[model samples]
Target: MISAQSLTKRFGSLTAVDAVSFEVGTGGVLGFIGPNGAGKTTTMRMLTGFLPASGGKAVVAGHDVFDEPMQVRRKVGYLPETPPLYRELSIGDYLRFVAEIRGIAARDRARRVGEVMEQVGLSGWERRIVGSLSKGYRQRVGLAQAIMHDPPVLILDEPTSGLDPAQVAGMRDFVRELANDRTVILSTHILSEVELLCPRVVMIAGGKKVADGTLDEVRHRATGGVRYRVELKGEPPDAIAPAVGALPQVDQVKPVPRPPGDGPHDPWDQGFRVLDVRAADDPRTAIARLATEQGWTLRGMERRVPGLEEAFLAIIGAEQ
Candidate 1:
């Protein structure tokens, strides 16, 4: 439903976005993420036809963003980082204005406005002046305007910004429902939101595409290899570390230090040592067998996978 091919944007002598490319299939939700000055907003603008790309191409809902700007705009619903609002207008008036400008027929404008208002939790708030609403309410108004036209594709930039915990959850659920039939590009700094809402991620850094893949694939790429957390109680703490490291299935082992006041206090946890084990393949079976032969008590053994935050830091840190 959306495709960017070597999309580049320049401002005078500076290039804001450099040859960034990715794709989102129909009914797909793609997470677009990067740090400050990473050109995430610039890319979104080009895709939505809000800003023209200096080089390359962008297609949205089967329309070329540069050649068919009007068609792309008609099919895309964009909510920028800041909710664009006219402070002087009342909530109902502002949304009605948006509906009219979006080409909603006069006969359907009222129903469209009411449905979007309720979708964004703005029901019965038509009389409230936009200027009088809080920051969270302003965001809701922005979302309502974006969806009022019921476009086939939605490009949301920080859709959950300024929202409280409950509002954030509701926004996530709403986006998930929208993805059942429409394509979505969710751009945000919140990695946890991406994990919950996006199955695939496109990460850019320094205005360049750095990583693009499924969540698990990106995590594996960032970590280099698989790792495990093994806790065991053995005859000697010092011997256990070297013994685990000496195993053919294990490549490296590092002992993890317990926190100052967070040591295990349970009787079952006594004498258990923790170590991070990295290997090409699963080493739990080997470690468990070794513990049994050595008469050591095995507390727990589990595979450890890097979370999105960890993967983000690792990838961005290397790029720098």
Candidate 2:
């Protein structure tokens, strides 16, 4: 429901966002990730028509952001890093104000406000003064205002920032529920949040698009081949390394000391033998067969995959 092509934004001599381009389909949740000063906010602002792009174009829900900014604004619900809130207003009053400004039908404004409040878990707290609420509650109030008009596209910047662990979980669940039919573009530095909430991610570094794809696809670009951790009994890790390295699929093997309290006589009689195996393909079968032939019992074997954090670090590191 959102598309951008060769979008660029410059502030004087500084380029806040380069020629970054991506698209979000209907009901798609695109996680936007980058470090501080990476221009994530600048890009979002340009997409939402809050800021003009130096070059290129963006379309929101079929409306050109620059040419038809009013229409684009009508279809998009945006919550920036700081909740644009009036501390003096009560929750109910603030949301009603937002509804009126967004041109919600006067007859349906109350119902819409109530529905969004309930959606964000702020039900029955409408009378409370927004300034008096805690950070979590205030965030819920901000979310309620954003969805008060029921826009088809929601652009949330750091939607769960500054919340306690419990609050963060609650907010994540709420955002997932919000995405049932609407398209969402959320920018966050929290990798775990992206892993739990986004189906696809668009990573940026140095104001440029660095990666865009499903989690596994991005990870594959960061790591070469598969990795495994294997533990063998009856042999020191130093002695087992060269033997395992001889297997055709095995690329490299390094021995690491076993953790405390997990030693030999713990079923597989494990001592300090731990092998870090990098292989082109699944070599567990070959390694197991080799262990069997050598009379060494296999204690533990596990595959390791590069996670989103690793993928993110790899991408940003290369850029630097």
Candidate 3:
């Protein structure tokens, strides 16, 4: 488990992280996201004891980050945006070094190193020099080192950065697997990856906490409310908007603009109009019934949940 209570970090007159607070349960991934320069890395550093907080407090695995830094470090596995690696050392030597420093017993170091290497898909890479590996392989090595001691908490900053599409997918799967037993704070710029891996999300912007909740809750808050897409073809295009808007279940309705060059006379256009309807509850059934009663041909109607990217922009854009 992890908790940040108004965690604040400052550099001279500038505040890198301003009283940001959130929590991650004992077992699951919590997506930590923000725009560039939003203080994501700063916050992670403070949580992992790599940087001291200028104000507020953080607790990791039930130990106060400030009071018991060594205990926190022992419980937390940190993978910064750039993996901390010694290029001159081969993968085996580097991980073995990490295992020893992390307090692994000398006799158990080899097995732990091998298990982590295999977990990160670097099983046979023991002899390869870390400096010679590609970006993807380097990331794997970084992850291997982070999990070498099998810490209960993982603070990963941009773990998939610089990885190709296939590598990104692989990393996502591995992170998901890791979340089975550990509490993970996953910070990344990739919103889609967060959507797939993190059921809960905490978004920061302008060095302050902007949003934090279950994925659906944050998206719903960012978008203002739930939405539905309704398409229909009928006699007076003007009547549809007013009729839908007048429905008690509908809070608002806006017509979707026709595509450019889509003329009224075009047969393919079918004189259909699309409306984005916003409401607190499902209105598709009512809308469909109304269309039938009004002799209008209902083309399609479906609920539309805003994507994480859309929600992210809406929240960050508002902060600006």
Q: What is the lDDT of candidate 1?
A: 0.91
Top of the candidates by TM-score: 3
Lowest-lDDT window of 10 residues in candidate 3? Answer: 259-268
lDDT of 2 at 131: 94
| lDDT for each residue of candidate 3 in 69-116, tens digit (9 for 90 to 100) | 999999999999999999999999999999999999999989999888
lDDT of each: 0.91, 0.88, 0.92
Residue 185 error, candidate 1, Å: 0.3
Best by lDDT: 3
Question: Which of the predicted structures, 1 or 2, would earn the higher lDDT when compared with the native?
Answer: 1
Better of 1 and 3 by lDDT: 3
Checking candidate 2 for backbone clashes, the offending pairs are 263-270, 264-269, 264-270, 265-269
Residue 12 C-alpha lDDT in model 1: 97
* 214-269 per-residue lDDT for model 1 (tens digits): 98889889986678988888887789999999999999998876655666655235
Order of candidate numbers by TM-score, starting with the best: 3, 1, 2
- Tens-place lDDT digits, model 2, residues 250-277: 9999776544674454433435367889
